[model samples]
Target: LHHLKTKRTEVYQDSSPFMSYSGCCCVLLPYSKCCYVLLPYSYRCYVLLTYSYLCYVLLSYSYRCYVLLSYSHFCYVLLSYSDCCY
Candidate 1:
């Protein structure tokens, strides 16, 4: 019984971080009977992951827009400062 308890603790410790990070508890415990404790958290974490991914995409787009705007501003300043004879 003590050995089983220790083994279970080791499994929980090993899987907990991965489950929490990716909602992939099923992947870890596929052959195990069922994950009553981890399933609900997995679903919730999946939703959170989706939202976080969307936020990441939006942030990337915003950064791109800022870069383009800065580049255009730099071009405008350069044009204003220069007196090309062409």
Candidate 2:
């Protein structure tokens, strides 16, 4: 885990260890779930969203202004059209 100045935060990456990503996952958060969401690394980068060792979704840049997202296995919508989470 990456330590901040004082507070301890969990270390998570957008890309999966077994899969691949290809879009800007301006990750907001899952609705009514206890999961972590990270900001997009770049405007055109890949991010693999996961939880509990389960690959939730594979992010990829579809278009210049397309908000591509995926629902979780439990029917959880982890992302939205506005992942511009700062």
Question: How close is each model in CA RMSD to the real structure?
Answer: 22.1, 13.1
Judging by lDDT against the true structure, name the best candidate: 2
Off by over 4 Å in 1: 1-21, 28-31, 36-86
- Per-residue alpha-carbon lDDT of model 1 for 1-86, expressed as tens digits? 01111112222224333333232221112233221122332342111122221221111121121111122223211111111111
Q: Candidate 2 on 1-86: residue-level lDDT in tens? A: 11112121233454355222234333323442223333355433333434555534423243112332333534334344443333
Measured by TM-score, how close is model 1 to the native structure? Answer: 0.15
Clashes of 2: 5
Cα RMSD, model 1? 22.1
TM-scores of all models? 0.15, 0.21
Give all candidates' CA lDDT scores.
Answer: 0.20, 0.34
